[model samples]
Target: MPRIPGGATGVVLALLLAACTGGPGDAASDEEAAQSPADPAFVADNEAWRAERRAALLEPDGWASLIGLHWIELPAHYVGSGATNGIRLAKGPEKLGMLQQQGGRVWLVPDPGAALTVDDAPAKERIELLPDVSGTPTIVAFDEGKGQLSLVDRGGRKALRVKHAEAASLTGLGPLEYWPADPAWRVQARFVAHPQGKTIPIMDITSRQAPQPNPGAIEFEHGGAGYRLEALEGEDGGLFLVFADRTSGHGSYGAGRYLYTAAPDAEGRVLVDFNRAYNPPCVFTDFATCPLPPPENRLDLAVTAGEKKYRRP
Candidate 1:
């Protein structure tokens, strides 16, 4: 597929699953719409949900805030906004701090009175940092909460990801478009559990290979054709589906889209609501590292339910 290189926060992902109801549009009249209860909240709720999604994506530390992704190569590198620093930050203090890697452990040593915070608390000296792969990551907040620094482990390589609230992409975001909601696209599927310890090779936009846990697969039928999508377990134990369809490069985001579904019931059945599918962070920012859909997850059918393409303005 084409490369469209993309943070997706928890709240934004939650809204994608909960607020998108794949049914009809608004009612004939105001009274009729609000009075008749055929999934009456569909239209109104979706509008409000889209607004929140946009706001969240533009948050101080959202994907739009991303400014740089510098790989940590040396044992210790000076981090600052000035060009003189080894790892120059796009926007931050002139000489913020230094990152030193000890015997497999990394520490952040702040410059004298550089004004950095560890986990929102003042960092007068040095502090250990955890990579994003770890469950808990140490956020080096600086520039008074507008700038954030963190370590990200990509394919066994460590890098410092930088974010600033005043990124140009945040202000240049164009409008988001979507196809009219269709209940028919919100089909059902059955979850088939994979053997224990099953995993799938996930490829990121940067062409890095990362093995992701594959708990199971979602089996469903559309257009009289059977399909299966590899399922990855999310933080809440729900099924996270990153997939591509015929619309991928035609009308939708060239990279693909994402969908979240509830865990399967005892019968191993889950609802695959395509209407709730959304574009990945790559749709908005090139810095985002979104995973590509595996071979099994690429469908020949055109999924015209969720979001449409976002042309940068």
Candidate 2:
């Protein structure tokens, strides 16, 4: 067999199964095509959206510029020695500033007459300070212990608090990689309802204690074998699945990829399209805490669909 670029052994299995089953015009192909939204129009739209998002994430002026992450527990006063202090402002290098903590508030004194901003907003209450490297001075204040950070945008919104950090996503170069868009892997599985919703205990990478939301189980048949998948509820209210099959560690992400099925239809039927399975956030950055697949979701059969393991950068 000619080797396919970026192809793995699992993909070969899926192709063999597809070849043995039927031709391109088979009913199964029709069903798989209907299930997959990879029709030219939808694929074009999806590609456009993904490219836009990727550009936003990778842009230098965007959140990817966040390079500092410090956790403070106690109230302490410190002076910013531009070189010593971890905080780096783009305005200049090695500029000294005053950082005072009083009543759970942090106040920063940038040079006198200089405009100060948080995240990207101009400082509301400006403080006068002595000149260091820059003659102009300004003051920026922040609530203590809040997840907010002060951004000094000289051009627009000089100072504002941004929730996401720039370096966090910038360093996340391990974007999800998927198998080729093959229709054979699109299997129509039946949803077997567990009247009493099933609960799957997930051990998160953070080692945090929490019970993952396993709504129920799904039963499907392939290659004369029976397989079952337990469903999990995601924060977005969409259904997520984390399952490991015989191909784990060999041909797929050892931790498993995530699959989302749309909310059940009026008749309570949901499509489990493996083609959309993707890598979890943990694949990209170590800072992310991802959930592992529960024992029940693990299968004995090889699932040759969705995304393959991400090669960390």
Best by TM-score: 1
Q: Scored by CA lDDT, what does every candidate get?
A: 0.75, 0.49
lDDT of 1 by residue, 141-214 (tens): 98899989998888778888888898887877788887665555667899899998999988766667678889
Number of backbone collisions per candidate: 2, 25
Q: Which stretches of candidate 2 lie over 4 Å from their true place?
A: 1-176, 195-198, 235-237
Q: Candidate 2: minimum summed lDDT over ten consecutive residues — where? A: 1-10
Kindly report the root-mean-square deviation of model 1 from the true structure over all alpha carbons: 8.1
TM-score of 2: 0.54
Q: Which window of 10 residues has the lowest lDDT sum in candidate 1?
A: 22-31
Query: Model 1 segments beyond 4 Å from truth?
Result: 1-40
* Residue 260 error, candidate 2, Å: 1.0
Candidate 2 structure quality by residue, lDDT tens digits, 1-313? 0000113434533432332333323422333333333567645654554566456646643444343323323343222325555443323324334444445344555544333455456554533322211333232322221223442322111222222333444656446554445454556676656556566676544333356556676777766778888887754444677766654555566666677777665555666767666666555544333565666766766665666766756
